[model samples]
Target: MKIAVDAMGGDFAPQAIVEGVIMAASSLPADTQLVLVGRQDIIKELFQKHGFESSAVEIVHADDVIEMSEHPTKALSQKPNSSIGVGFKLLKEKAVDIFCSAGNTGAMHVGALFSIRAIEGIIRPAIAGFVPQVNGKHAIMLDIGANADCKPDVLSQFGEIGSLFARHTLHIDHPRVALMNIGEEEQKGSVIAQAAYQLLKENKRIQFVGNIEGKDLFTDKADVIVTDGFTGNILFKLGESLYGILKERGIEDEFIARTNYESIGGSPIIGVNGNVMIAHGISSPLAIKNMISWARQQVEANAYIHIAQALA
Candidate 1:
């Protein structure tokens, strides 16, 4: 299978990104092809330094680099030669099975929609992030930052998709899905959330477990937590900040280590036409390697197909 890499999108740029691809190529099967998309000259030099076989790794030149600070829409429209643009092009053309990047996420999302597009039944695609719970369980949170305002139908879609991820990826049999809200009662939270809660509770396909508050996130009370992109994004940032604060305080080292971004590697954008993995911008080589492997795993498992079937 061919997996495309955006070599210039991350903070460390070509160096760390190339190193991560080399690591993945070395450990993966001999036939696994890694197409590194970025500046040709810099990628070649990095490959020589790492002593990777030229045949196994190929560099596709992209002239421009999309800066994190730039506006995503403007950048995407103007920078056709950007790494993000090239990678998405390859994905759209079926030249690659998966596209993985540590770039500006908004740009990535916009570019993906423009290029490869979303799945047939999906409305706007959702970003599914992993939340590590106590007792070695992990919960899936949807629309983590994709769409801020969601209607009742959109939120219901998140519940279905999130539950599918828990069952398929986390191997949770009959995963318990919950809507994130101010209180656990059905009448609590905004009108949108309350209406979503009612639909989820009545849906036969999912095992809806009522509303789940923020405090119940890490306690393994639910396997799949559904929230609109706005609330979900806030919780995600807050959780990351909490981990940073705990690490700085030098307390809960063991717990903090488990919940770190580097450890999680990356998040998979669900309901997209093709597989796409988005790692943290500050991701190290090890984290990038893990992201590549996870992307490959998702492709081999036909993650999109299963998700669609489960949702249907």
Candidate 2:
């Protein structure tokens, strides 16, 4: 399987991204093709510096780079040769099975939507990531940063999609699903959330576990949490901050090293027609390597196909 890496999108740019690509090319399965998408000259220099051949990691020349502040729609239209645009175009053409980037998150989302397009039944493509809870259990959070305003139907779809991901990817049977809310009562929060909660509670596809407050995030109360992108992103960042503080306290050496930003690598964007993994801007070589492995596993498991069928 071929995975395209955006070598110039992140804050660290070509340097860290190139190192990660080299590491993946060397350590990953021999058949896995690593397509490094970025400014060709700089990427080649990094490869040469590391004593790796250009053949080891294929270069997909992209003339422009999208700034983090640039709007996705604007970048896609104005900067056709940008890394985000070129990399996404490659995915659309089936040049690669997966597209990975540490670039502007908004640009990535917008580009993927137009490039790979969303599945037929999907209302909005959700950006999802697994948050580790107590006893190594994970809770899948959806709409982490995709769509902000969502209708009740959108939230219900998020729960359904998130549940499928937990079952197929994480091997969870009857994964408990919860709507992030202000209270445990059914009438709590905005009308949209309340209505969504009602539908989720009555839905048969997922094991709807009722409302989950922000405090319950790490309590092992739910395996999959669904919310609109606005709330989901807030909770995601909050969780990250909490984890950061925990690390700063120097709690557990093992968990600290394992759960750090550099270690976690990337988050997979679900609901799209293909695989697109988005990494942290500050991701290290190890994290990039992990992202490649994660993307390969998703392809091997046929996660996107399984999800497409499940959503259908």
How much lDDT does each candidate structure score? Answer: 0.84, 0.84
lDDT of 2 by residue, 48-111 (tens): 8998874557899999999978888988899999999999999999889989999999999999
Per-model TM against the reference? 0.92, 0.93
Candidate achieving the largest TM-score:
2
Clashing residue pairs in candidate 1 (N, C-alpha, C atoms within 3 angstroms): none
For model 1, state the Cα shift of residue 68 in Å: 1.2
Candidate 1, residues 286-307, lDDT tens digits: the string is 8888888877776776567787
